[model samples]
Target chain A: MTDGIPAAPGTDAWFHDGPDGFVLLAGRCTACGALSFPPRPIPGCPNPDCDGLEQHPHALSTTGSLWSYTDARYVPPPPYPRPPDTEFSPYALAAVELDAERMIVLGQVAPGVAVSELTVGMPMRLVPGVLVSSAGVEERVWNWRPGA
Target chain B: MSRPDSVAVLGVGMHPWGALGKSFVEYGLVAARAALADAGIGWRDVQLVVGGETIRNGYPGFVAGSALSQALGWQGAPVASCYAACATGAQALSTARAHILAGLADVVLVVGADTTPKGFFAPVGGDRPDDPDWLRFRLLGATNPAYFGLYARRRMAIRGTTEADFAAVKVKNARAGSLNPYARFRAEVDAETVLNSPMVSDPLRLLQICATSDGAAAVVLASEEYARRKQRDAVRIRAISAITPEYPRTVPDFPYLASDSAAISPPASRTFRESLAWSAYESCGLGPEDMDLAEVYDLTTAMELDWYEEIGLCAAGEAEKLLHDGATALGGRVPVNASGGLSSFGEAIPAQAIAQLCELTWQLRGDAGTRQVAGARAGVAVNQGLFGHGAAMVVAHA
Candidate 1:
């Protein structure tokens, strides 16, 4: 295993280690209280009645319900972190619905998990995981793990 | 019934779909010329040309309108290009219809074609991670099939749908495809064949998913008065619903990692896919009952079932039941994809929506050969793309 220090890529700045645990960065509409993930250039509130645009940084809940799940049964196309020397491995993916935010966010299931083991509406929690590691760094990402 | 805004589909044509190993422009030109000949008009007779774009082909594909015009000898016809991912063909058709409806042109030619690369379509070569398409593959290793798999699984959980039900869809489409001369895969497949095929995504097999293909389709659309001069009757495009999703969309769609939070604002009364055909039906004063046939995008056998419900063929969660009853098969009450759908043609991208219109044209004109929908009078063609782009069109005898 790569012992490199953990770091987040520029595009994955939303993944953060909060005091309590792993939390996804989101935005809360200052006016209408709308919530959005990866909240840069915070989008306008989705509510048609509200014209509010300004949103402040907010942390999303770490736990949610599994809305759906599947797996990459075949080798995916490039830019999917396949080092030329490594063999492809199928992995499970899940869409978790954050109850508080009332939004569904997609993420990889924790390693070793399979689609057969997951069911819709089951409880899941966010956990820190390494997306890929190279050179002297471990690129970190969030994974959805089964159980509360 | 033909409304005041209806535009006549004077002629339609297509190049056979397959890995023909030819340039996209070449395929488009052949189909365009074929449509012109079928319309009994010369190239110079056209007033406008609309091209559905294919970004994979680089600069020429991006500006396909001008490229096709140049390839056709540049008669100085006014041209426009449209790009809306899988909905490109529909967008191009919509542009041509608008030009005719607004009386900007008496005769317009619409064309779309593509030469897809092998295997899964990857995002354009780049290092920038801002693209959701790139991020999905990089972060989650989620291919297009992954999303389809997700939707399929969700449907199974909610509706008690089974793998056999999904395989049955492929069987039906493959049976129809066998009769379509233009289809790439012309051999009929059985449910067992579909089920036994190697799995590309869990609960979805290789035979159940459409392949990326190289093909082209074209149509000549003209004003009602112009069409009347040459023909006693014509197939008229009654409506084209090129629409987008509403705010706070709760369902997860392609190329998006997160769905809008509906906690603050309630979800729309109709989901995005449902609204597509709804808008078309409202515009044309038509309903699901009025449709004699349909040509829906069958990206996956499972997605086709979804379209049946979204298009109001049946109530929610009733598509599986409808399929088993053979209501959507040829000789049934409302035959769908009588032209074999994407299951046969694979996906020519830009050419697909126009191809759907071509199938509707032939069926409405009583010209479809072996795969004809008997006495078909009215039909609907529907498809959706990434990032909230969707299109649904209604066609009827004028």
Candidate 2:
């Protein structure tokens, strides 16, 4: 697999390629075991009772169930950068609920997927996909696809 | 309930909503003058002014209270500005009510206005990658409607809701809006028009989603004693809930990329949307049964249905049944959005919540000519903004 450029600031910081597949990075409170995404430093654990300031990097589940799905049929205005020389086309999006994490993560659906093909509670797996490409370089991001 | 502490709503007014090709200051001043006239008072009578801030405009928009006050021939009144995305107007009202109830101010003016550009609302200009609003657009090309569409599809999948059911909401709101002179789209549309409208986000048609509009609304609020002194019958604000979400929020809201992980800690029992109205009801010692009407944020037709359950007007997954039963239409058991909602007046951001209050005031006063809810004794308005801003208010006839 080829490494691609991170699409947003702090993007490269929170995700990476793992032995199994792509995984999202999160901050786990060392004391109370609470998890936060984008791995940013918060004042402390979200738990009001816990004053735990220590945290460690934790990997998130790569597979989940589809919570909901939609397709954006209109072209979004900037700062949404469109690919060079390509006409605008509708793209599907999904909110997938990670079973173990017990949280919802949103992502673009795989390239060929359509809204009609998706269903709520159906199993979905995350895979590396390109958000945009220019000058022989691809902007890598995670995508949800129906599978184990 | 031991008479919940309240503030008297003396008067309310609005600038007709549409692309009026005017400045935010213009709309705000017009609405302010109308409200002051309705209250039968001069600008000098107001002890304080609270303005809902508009982020889209420049520096003056951020300090809207000062701008409106300067426009209204400054009386040197104390002023405050509030910003909470879509909930800005509610926050402004909450601020005004707080001052009146605190004995620091006797009469307060609350105003909100915006002159929005056409098309989807984009993040403010810049390459700030740390900003989630900008990142959502840059990374996923997700517009606000994309989030609404997701919610609509989720409801359909889980609750057996249909596209036609959503269309009915638009049809209902449009008919109500037709009677509202200040609404943007005052022409009623049929279910066919809504169903056939081009899809902006799958499951949400162009007609189903609200447009960006230029508008303003203002209200005059005073202490109950002041109202009694004036010998005026006024609406009383029973409660204002500007609560934020609790910890371990599980549902995905707008602008946020992900929900808080409940892997270790259990999730909050009530969703953030539900909690907004819950706090208002709890504070006022009122329940859904006490409401004669409701003016909920209908950013999309589907969201109107969601508010039904969130505000406890109906049980979860039963909004469709309530709609079919005609319980939420004008002249029904309890009308919702009798002022046409966002379906008729698109969103003017900071102005919306204040506009909802204006409708409630008119209805309770029996001044809403054609679309009035019969003998509306109590009402509620609820809306949530990007991030965790939750706004809700309950008002009763005084």
Candidate 3:
């Protein structure tokens, strides 16, 4: 954290460094027992048949397995906040499957992990990281690191 | 069981695909005129017009039906506009078919045109956190190729597919594209060329990906009676299936941060793309074995392989084996992308699905000079778009 505040507000609600460890906020449906990440905005369960409007905030398991991975070799177009072209370096993205949630989540991998170093089915854990540094404040984002 | 009533495709036309410095309206007019002339029907004869919307053209793009009708000298024909991302053209054709089958129109003109911007397609301006497309680009810098790369890597891991298999797709499609006059990239490519190309995403080379291009495609469809009066033999549209994924979609799709969890229930046996093809097969009472040719959305060489399995041409994880056996190449069993595919045409967005239909029509009619699938009878065109849009059409000789 910079300036004693999270760079991207509201993002902290999704993931933060708790006293125990990293926890991901998710939504659990009371009626159908459905679970969703990033929480549904409508306050209702996605299940069409179940009219479960009462959604309770729940913490998701931080550990998962690498379902897939890729390396972005080219620079993407705008609105993607990044350093200048000269400072740019390719980064690897990973899709991790949380066994408890039975869902796959996508995130940037930790800085040092290269594409060659990673393999499918490798265990990974969620960790807080910086997406970009601007105005002397590091934009908080989540990353997947190899090992639980 | 008696087959459902069908609509006849009286004529089909297209504007060559490439980076042309022209407006979409200009290209649309040329394709519309050619289609009308080919059908031997005047513009005034068409009772309805359906146009595929283009995102690049501002507000007018939303009302593409009226814009194209105006460009063709409108005769007060009823107009409908549709947008389903890359599946726009198929939706437009479906709309025209509905009008004809319902007795609302005797003849319908279906058109789709687009002038794509250079570089990777970015989200429309403004920051709307609710917009998934914007979030994907802003948070992860995930371009379209990034998603393609992920799928390719997953296939490699799960199916033991090799990079050489991916490169082989490019070589095969490029060779077919060399015979297609309408294709932008007419030069044949080899495995060396694909391997030597710079990497845009891991496991995918630059030449293996499609580029953005400008193009237009149109078709004239008529009621069974009207078509019989004009020409006894015409290409008949047996079915056009535009389907969305079922709830709890397990597979990862574009513009999404995560896949829907399957905690409450097990994932479906069929994937989203497989279901799309199955819907068309059920609608037409035909299976993959009935197909003589196919034109699929090959946004990347790897994607083409995925389509081969999804379309039921082979079993899961056997697409590479099918390719190696020369079953998907021109003159092979169930030849695919005989029009050279997006690998050769690049992507013109709205125009692509209709362009696929144009190739199918030519092949069925024995009019495709050089790239003809000999003795072709029935063909299928399959495509998927962002935000859960999937479309497929089955066509055969009347």
DockQ of each: 0.72, 0.76, 0.69
* All candidates in order of DockQ, best leading: 2, 1, 3
Residue range with the least summed lDDT across 10 consecutive positions in model 1 chain B? B126-135
Per-candidate TM-score against the hidden true structure: 0.97, 0.97, 0.96
The residue pairs that clash in candidate 2, if any, are none
lDDT of 3 by residue, B19-40 (tens): 9978898888888988998888
Q: Which of the two, 1 or 2, has more lDDT?
A: 2
- Which 10-residue window in model 1 chain A sums to the lowest lDDT? A1-10
Query: What is the lDDT, from 0 to 100, of the residue B258 in candidate 1?
Result: 88
lDDT at B85, model 2: 91
**Candidate 1 lDDT over residue span B29-67, tens digit each:** 999999999899889999999999998999999999888
Query: Relative to the true structure, how large is the alpha-carbon lDDT of every model?
Result: 0.88, 0.89, 0.87
**TM-score of every candidate's chain A:** 0.83, 0.87, 0.86
Q: What tier of docking accuracy does candidate 3 attain?
A: medium
Per-residue lDDT over A7-112 for candidate 2, one digit per residue giving the tens place of the 0 to 100 score: 4443765677856677878788899998877565455876776899877888889999999999888889987767688888788999999999898999899998
- Among these predictions, the greatest lDDT belongs to 2
Off by over 4 Å in 2: A4-7, A41-43, A133-137, B1-4
Q: Give the Å shift of residue B136 in candidate 2.
A: 1.2
